[model samples]
Target chain A: MPDAGSRTASIGLEGGRAVTARPTAGAPRSVRATAARIAGDWLPAVPLLILAVLLLVLPTAVVVLQSFRGETGGITLANWAETLSRKSDRRAIATSLELGALVGTISLLIGAPLAWAISRALPAARTAWLSLLNVGANFGGIGLAFAYTAVLGTYGMVTLALQRLGLPFTPPPSTSFTGLAMAYFYTNIPLFILLTLPAMHTVRDDWMEAAEVCSATRFQFWRHVGIPILTPFLLAGWVLIFTWTVGIYGLAYALAGSAPAAPVRLMTLQIGIALNQSANGQQRAAVMAAILLIIATVSLVTYRIILRRATRWFS
Target chain B: MVFVGRLGRGALFAALAIYLLLPLSAVLLSSFATTWTANPLPDGYTLASWGEALANPRLQAAVARTFGLAAAVLVLDILLVVPAVYWQRVRNPRIRVVTELCAAIPFVLPFIVIAFGILKLTGFAIPSLLGTPPLLLLGHAAIAFPFLYWSVDGAMAAANVVKLNEAAQMCGATPLQTLRHIIVPNIGPGLATGGMLVFATSFGEFALVQVLVGARFENVSLYSLDLLTRTSADFGTLAVLTVLTFIVLFVISTGVVWSNRGKRGTAVAGARAMTAEKDA
Candidate 1:
C-alpha cells in the first residue's frame, strides 16, 4: 500500500530537472533537499523500509539465493533434490505436519469453547482471562520447554506423583515427541483463544437474543448461528497454529536437544544438524528452510484469506 | 438450561486454571525444595536453590546483561515501531495492508530461519560484530517490531491520535511538537503496553540466541537451555533459574497488563479494530 504520490514525489525530486541542472552540486544542499523531501513526505516509512530490507527481505533473498547455488558457485537444483530426498528429511517433514495437524485440531476444540466463554464473561473476567492468555502466549519458546520439563520430565514432580499413586501411566519427559506435542498444546490453546476471542464477539449478543426470542435453545442457537459465524475464524486460527507449530524450533530445541539423544522429529532440528555437519550443510539447510517457508507461507496466506472473510461481517 | 450452562462453564474454567497453573507450581515448588522425589509435595523446603543460584556472580552478570538487552530492545522497538504504526494509522491507509502482512510474517517465518539469516548476514557483512549483543539487539528489535506495532496501533485508535493530531495542528503546534507533546503522551498507556510486549519478547527469546550467538553469550533462556542440556545439569539450579525467569516475565506483564486498568488488553485491542474499518 505504498502511497503512489509520495513515492513519485521522492523519486521525481531525486532525479528531476531542478536537481539535474546542478548535477555537480553534490554537497549538503542536494543532500538536505533529498533529506527534507524524505522527512516531509515519507518519514514514517523510512524506518520500516530499512527494517524490512535488512531483517526480512535481504535475509530471505540470501537464503533463496544460497539454496539455488551449488558449492562450485554454479546454479543447480541438487540442493532441493537432496534436501527432499533424504529419508531423515522426509521424516522431519512428516513429523512437522503430524504435529501441526494434531496440535491445531486439539487446540481448536479446547480453545473455541474457552474463547466463547471468556468473550461472554463480564468485563473484569474477560480482562483477567485475556491477561493470562497474553502471558501464556509470551511464555512460549524456551521457557515453555522448561515449564513442561518442570512438571513432566523424568524426575519431574508430576511424573513422580503419578508413580506414587500407581496411575499406570508415566508422563513422558519433555524431551519426547509426546512431551513436545503436549508443550505445544499448552501454547497453541492460548494463542487460538486470543486470536479467536474477537470473532466470538462477532456472534453479537443481540443476534443471540433475536435467536432466543424465535424459540431457540442454546444448543440450537450455537449449532445454527454461533457455529456458522465462528467456523471461518476457527479454521483461520487452526491454520495459524499449524503453520506456527510446523516451523517451531525453539520450543522443540529447548525441550529436546538437537542431537539424537532426545530424537525430536522436527524439520528445524534438521536445519540444526545441517548447521553442524559440514561446509555444504548450510546449503541443505537453505533448501529445507525454503521448503518449510513455502509450507508456512501457503498456510498463512490461507489463514489471511479466511480471516478476511470472517471479519468481513464486522462493522 | 441455565444450570447446565453454569456447570459447563465452571468445569471449563476450572480445567483451564489447572492446566495453566500446575506446571508453574511444579517449578515454584522445586525452586524452594531441598528434595523432590515420588512425593506429591516436596519432602522438605529450603532457600538453598535460590540462594545458590543467585549467589553465582556470573549468573548475576548474565541477568543484568539480559535485562539490559531487553531494555535496549524495548527502546529500539519504540523508536522503530512507533513511527511506522503512527504513519500507517494517521497518514497512510495505503500502507495498512502491506504493514499488516509484515506484521504477520514472524508468525509463519520461524525465528530459526531468521537466526540463520542473521548469522549469514552479520558474519558475511560485518565479521567483527558477529555473535555480539548488538546483533541480538538488532534481531530482537526487528522480531519484536510487530508486537509493539500491534499494541501501539491499538493505542493510537483508543487515543484517537488522528483527531488529536489535527486539533494540535490547529492550535499552532508543528507536526514534531504535535507527536512529541500531544500524541505520545496520550498513547502513554499504549507505549507501556507495547513496552511490556517488546520487553518480554526480547527477554525470553531463545532461538535467536541459541542459533546466532550460542554459547558465546547466554541470556536467561539460553542459560536454562544450557543447564538442561549440560551432562551434569543441576536440577536445583535449573529450577531456581526457570522459576526466576517466569516470575520476572509474569510479574512485569501482570503489572503492566493489569495497570492498563485492563484496557481490554491493548495488545489485542486492534483485533476488534481490524474489522472496525479505519476511520483515518
Candidate 2:
C-alpha cells in the first residue's frame, strides 16, 4: 500500500497540510532556501548529467546530424528519398512488424502459462525454474544462433531425429524465416515470463475466494477477475517484446548471410547494410536509425502507459 | 481454469524445460563430437575441439579480450552508477527522473543504432577513437547503464540508505566513514547482482564490437562469429567456444541467485529490476 511517491509526499509540505504525520520537522521556506534546494538537487548530479549527455545525447545527436548531411559535403535529402523509395527498405520495415507480432503472440502464449505454472510451484521449484529461464534468456547472440542451427538446422540433431521417426513435419533450417522465428521465440518466451511473473504475484488468492463465495464458477472468476487483472501486464509484455523485434541486431546479424541478402530483412539488419555501403550507406544508416529510434521510443512509451494503467488497476 | 489445473501445469513446465535445455545441450554435445552428422547424438565424443579451441591464438586472444572488456565495463559502470545513484537517492531525490531516463536510452535506441551512432562519431569527430579498444569499452559501459542504475536504486530504496546515512551522520560519523562502514555493506547484494549482469552483458556483446573493430580486437563473441562465417571454419571450435562462454555466464547467474538466497524469489531485487528495465 505504501509506495515511494506517497511516502515522500510530506517532505516539502508547501501548504503545511502534510500527507503523513511522522513527527517530521519542516525546514523553514525562503527564497534563499528554494534556490539552495534547486542547487542541491542539480549540482550533485552534474557528473551524472554530463555522462548522460556525453554518452546518450551526444552520439544520438551525431546520428541525427549525419542523417541530414550530404555526400557532396552539403545538406541533402537524397539519402532519405532513396531510403523511403526503396522496396527492400520498406519490406524490411514490414518484416520487422510482422516478426514482432508473430514472436510476441507465440511468446505470450507459452510464457504466460509458464509464468502461472511457476508461480503455483513450491518455492524451491519456483526459484530453480526462474534461474533456468534466466539462463535461456541470456543464452543469446552468436552463440544462440549457432546453437539453434546445430539443433534445428538441415542436418540438425532434432531435424535428423525427426527424420528417423518419419514424422510428417520437418522444421525449417535455423537460417530460414520460420527457423529464425523459432529462435526468437526461444529467447522471448523466457523474457515474457521474467517480465510478467512479478505482476502475477499481485493476484491474491483471497480475491478468488471472494469470487467463489459470490457463487462464481472457476471459469467465471477467471473471465471477470484473472484475465482483466493480467491483460494490461500481458499487453505491456507484448509491447516490450515488439519493441525489441524492431531494434534487435545481434541475433539477426548473426543469422544474416549477408546484410542485403539476409533471408529476413529486419530494420536492424537493413541499417547494418546501409552502414556498410560507403558514404551514402552511412547516411542511409543514420536515417534508418533515426526512424527506428522513433518507433522504439513510441513502442516503449506505449509499454510504459500500459504498465501505468496496470499499476493503477492494482491500486 | 480447471481445464489447466495442476497436471496441465506440470506438462507445461516439462515442455519449457525441454525447450530451454535442448539447444544448449546440443551445443555442448557438438563441442565434444569427433564427427556428428545426420544423427540424434554425436557418433563419437572427443576432446579434439576443446583442444583445437585452446590451441588457436585467436580463440585465446578472444577469450582473454572478452574477459578484459567485461571487467572494464563492470568497473566503469560501478564507478559511474554507484556513487551517482547513491547521491541521487540520499541527497537529490528529484534527480531520479533524469537518471532513470538516461539509463533507459539503451532500450529506446536498440543496440545496433547505438553501435551505428558510436561508429559514425568515432569515424569523423574522434578519429583517434575509431577502431580502438577505448571506444568499444565506452560503448559497453553505456549500453550496460540501465542494469547498474536500477540495481543500485532498488538496493538504496530497500536498505533505506538515506535513513541509514541520516542516522549515522546524526550520531557524528563522517560521511566517508558512513559510506565505508554502512552503505557499501548494505548495498553489497545489489552491487554484486548488477555487476554480474553487466559483466554477462559485456561478455556476450557482439554487434558493437563486430561493427566497430571487427576482427581487429576480436572478443569471444566475435571469435565465435568468425568461426561461423569463414570457409573451412569448424563448428566444433565454435561449439566449444560457445559452451565455455555459457558456462561463465551460468556461473555468474548462479552467483546472482546465490547472493539473493535467503530473500526468496520475491526479494530478488536485482533480478526483478532487470525485468522492469527490459519493460523500459
Q: Model 1 over residues A132-240: C-alpha lDDT tens digits?
A: 6865666676667767867777677777778788886678666677888999988788888886775665677898899889989888898898888889878977887
TM-score, each model? 0.88, 0.90
Docking quality class, candidate 1: acceptable
User: Which portions of model 1 miss their true places by more than 4 Å?
Assistant: A1-39, A123-135, A259-262, A276-280, B1-4, B87-98, B170-172, B259-280
Q: Score the docking of each candidate (DockQ).
A: 0.38, 0.43
Q: lDDT of model 1 at residue A294?
A: 85
TM-score of chain B of each: 0.87, 0.89
Candidate 2: pairs in clash: none
Over A19-135, each residue of candidate 2 has an lDDT whose tens digit, in order, gives 132234475677886687567556646766776776677778888887788887778888789888888778878888899899998888877877777767888788779878977
Docking class of 2: acceptable
